[model samples]
Target: MGVCLVLIVLAWNVVRLWSTTAAVVMSVVAAVLPPIAAVVANWGEDH
Candidate 1:
């Protein structure tokens, strides 16, 4: 997802310099988002 990619890029480039822990947290959250989006997107689908 676009949001996930943005978070990762920002975490790597910007956040990491400020705090590696925070960047790792952001990356973890970003990693979780796409699967959540997929589940939500298909939540009520017939197939």
Candidate 2:
């Protein structure tokens, strides 16, 4: 759900910027951080 929201926002920005470079930067940020946080959160939860 959160990822979807981020994707929508990135899509909106991509429309404005319309550059592959900008999209890649946005995608990298969107792609990387959440999984890291999710793993940490899940590990803490399991303990």
Candidate 3:
């Protein structure tokens, strides 16, 4: 996520009008949720 943000910032700096904000947002969500989902799935498997 930090890398994505850095890329976005670099692109914005280079192009000054890049439209990858959604990609950055999606990358952040994609970074955070899957492991949480996996843990929830594992916990539920025992119950």
Candidate 4:
């Protein structure tokens, strides 16, 4: 979560100006992180 937010903030505020493609890729990676985190968090849990 924290990492995701940081990535997004950097992507928009810093990386975008230098390279839109890199920024978009970072944003996409940030977007995917939460759900992956959720799945990892729940993995092997008993519900």
Candidate 5:
């Protein structure tokens, strides 16, 4: 859900600014954050 929000904002900015660099950077972040967020959110819960 949080990841979705980030992607949505990224899309909005990409569309609004039409900047390739911003798109690429946001795309990288959008790709990377979900797994990281999941790991952080679930860290140590199985103990």
Candidate 6:
């Protein structure tokens, strides 16, 4: 849910900016961070 919300905000900014390099960078971060975060956040739970 949080990831979805962040994606929506990033998408809105990307649309608003429409041609900026930062939007591209943010889009990449939005694509990559969630899964990495999920792993890191859960890394010790199983033990």
lDDT of 5 at 25: 68
Question: Per-residue alpha-carbon lDDT of model 1 for 1-47, expressed as tens digits?
Answer: 88999999999999999999999999999999989989999999986
lDDT of 5 by residue, 3-42 (tens): 7677758766654487767667667777788888889999
lDDT computed for candidate 6: 0.71
User: What TM-score, to 2 decimals, does candidate 3 have?
Assistant: 0.41
The deviation in Å at residue 7 for candidate 2 is 3.9
TM-score of 5: 0.56
User: Which residues of candidate 5, in runs, are more than 4 Å off?
Assistant: 2-18
The TM-score values for the models, in the order shown, are: 0.88, 0.45, 0.41, 0.88, 0.56, 0.53
Query: How well is each residue in 1-47 modelled by candidate 4, as lDDT tens digits?
Result: 89999999999999999999999999999999999999998998995
lDDT scores for all predictions? Answer: 0.96, 0.68, 0.61, 0.96, 0.74, 0.71
TM-score winner, 2 or 3:
2
Global fold similarity of model 6 (TM-score): 0.53
Better lDDT candidate (5, 6): 5
**TM-score pick, better of 2 and 5:** 5
Q: After superposition, how far is residue 12 of candidate 4 from its true place, in Å?
A: 0.8
The number of clashing residue pairs in model 5 is 0
How well does model 4 score by local distance difference test? 0.96
- The list of candidate 1 runs beyond 4 A from truth reads none
Question: Residue pairs in steric clash, candidate 3?
Answer: none
**Model 4, TM vs. native:** 0.88
